[model samples]
Target: MSVPLFDAATPRAPLREGLRSAIDRVLESERFVLGPEVASFERELAAYCGASQAVGVANGTDAITITLRAMGAGPGDEVIVPSFTFYASVEAIVHTGATPVFCDIDADTYCITPETVRAALTPRTKAVIAVHLFGNVAPVGEIQALGVPVLEDAAQAMGSRSAAGRPGSLGVAATFSFYPSKNLACFGDGGAIVTNDDAIAEEARILRFHGSRDKIDYEQVGYNSRLDELQAAILRVQLPHLDQWSDGRMQAARNYEEAGLAELASLPKPVAGASPAWHLYVVSHPDVKRLEGALAAAQVGYKPYYRTPVHRQAPMLEWGAGVDLPATEHAARTHLAIPMSPGLTRAQADEVVAAARAAS
Candidate 1:
């Protein structure tokens, strides 16, 4: 059988019963739009994250955009973002009519460092997006001390925690995605913005629902970005087991590390002082293409999280300062993810490590 790169975990059969019941209740009540399910999920999520409030959105991108808009980050403002991240991070800044300043990441953790962010800051810089890439949390406390609004892109980092707090807990707002591949994925697309600021939460809620605090009154121009009730129901069921699944993935990572395959090639390490959720087990070799081919021949699946960093991506090339970013450039060429998921067993991890060792 072909070894797939990942197989996302789902709620246990018993846990899914509640999800089904919740869906059935929503169906019976015919409250498909921002209803009791969404509200309750938001509250639960907020409490779990140690936030005062949470607002459900259509997806993570909208969560970032709405939060940015509410923060008054607009044209002429620059948002510092790590170049080595998913496009959505930069896309949200651009969507807000703000300029995204690309910054390099740390060699070890593959996360944007506070020093890099400091260097990228300018007179127009208003916000910084700390992306918790590959389930590793960024050093947000130091970044927050820069006196700029911080946006936590926690799409791949659900259930990840730091001593200070969760990924977004230190930021002005944290955005999360329920994409199928994420650690806390839903049945379909969904997202949420978590924050302690009541005003920011209220504004995101309004902006997500067409800028209306009241049903009939339009407060400000906005977009439709509400998370569906069904999706919230799915998330609620999944959230309870999120920590368990994350630990399973972490166990898989430890198994891979103990297998001693990392000695064969340079591997990405989790960020210091942060507990990663192990969204993907990424590593790098000098000749990534050759390694990838070997894995293919061995039927061991792999993927490149960001084959092209956002600043280098064709669509967002304008974000670059034409500076030489050795780290980001090197990462784009060598980064490769091995099979890693809550569903991945030790045997599966061993097989992947064996293939990688042979390739190395």
Candidate 2:
């Protein structure tokens, strides 16, 4: 049996008709950019995430840059971020002219903890990006207690939650990606910045456009990165079903244990009290080569993530020349995310586990 990672098309099968109707509605309106579709998505997304407001943007990376600028981060400021996450997290900080301070992550959770954040803080530290990596929510409330504003990097955690609350509500502000792979994905590129702070929300809205609330005047320089109507309309159609899908993913993750994968490899340990969306069902083994060979021979779909930590990337060499990220390096070497999605079936999951058994 062949198991494939991330069956994006399968999940959309159930929503095909609704998606078509949504597209038709957008076509009838004939308003593409920053129209009613985008406006409604912003409002609905904010409410779903337990936030005061949300501003739609072109993509997840733009969402980060706009939110950072709204929080007053710029040159001469430092923003602490975990090196274990996606490159977009660091790129946005650099785009804002803020120096990116690399932070290490906890080995178990693969997320920056309050201890790690404290170690990276300086007098010039203006903000911290708490990445809710792989659908596991970061400890934003604890990190926020450190004084600097904490931004929730929720690109992979749209349906995730912690005891404190949802991702967008936990941090000063949060950013989400609606890429086809995400939990709350649109058909194509789309993103949003959500916050409880009305001041930040107002600034983000202006920044997403051409730096002006009204088209007549320009305030500060900004980007032309607004989310389009078609994508937003499709996302709106999917929003109501997200919770059920996320629950399904979480249940699928548990099936790995039923297949006895834990006996063969180390499964991810989510943070205490976290109800993760399980965007990727990652596992680690001491011998990576063996695991790789077994999965390939069995035709089990899998992908190694962050083999090179963002801080160690060529463009970031100068920034990370002397940084010591022990835990981040370990995760980079060991982690491999396997097939995971609401559409995943028991037979596919069994194939992956059988491969792991052979590897062990």
Deviating ranges (above 4 Å) for candidate 2: none
Residues 1-360, model 1: lDDT tens digits: 356888763335557678788778778988887888899999999988988899999999999999999988999998898889888888998998999888889977889888889889999998899999899999888888988888899998999888888865778889999988888888889999999999999899899978998769999889899999888888888888888888887887887877786876676687778889888888888889888988898899888878777776777867674756789988888999988877677677678777877776
RMSD of each: 1.5, 1.0
Q: TM-score of the candidate numbered 2?
A: 0.98
Tell me model 1's lDDT, rounded to 2 decimals.
Answer: 0.85
Candidate 2: Cα lDDT at 228: 94
Q: Give the winner by TM-score.
A: 2
- Global lDDT scores for all candidate models: 0.85, 0.90
Q: How much is the lDDT of residue 316 in candidate 1?
A: 80
Location of the lowest summed lDDT over 10 successive residues in candidate 1: 7-16
lDDT tens digits, residues 1-360, model 2?
A: 388878767767889999999999999998989999988998999999999899999999999999999999999999999999999999999999999999999888888999999999999999999999999888888888988789999999989889989989998999999998899898789899999999999999899878998978999899999999999999999999999889888888877778778888888888877889988887877888789889989887788989999999999987888799999999999999888988777677788888888887
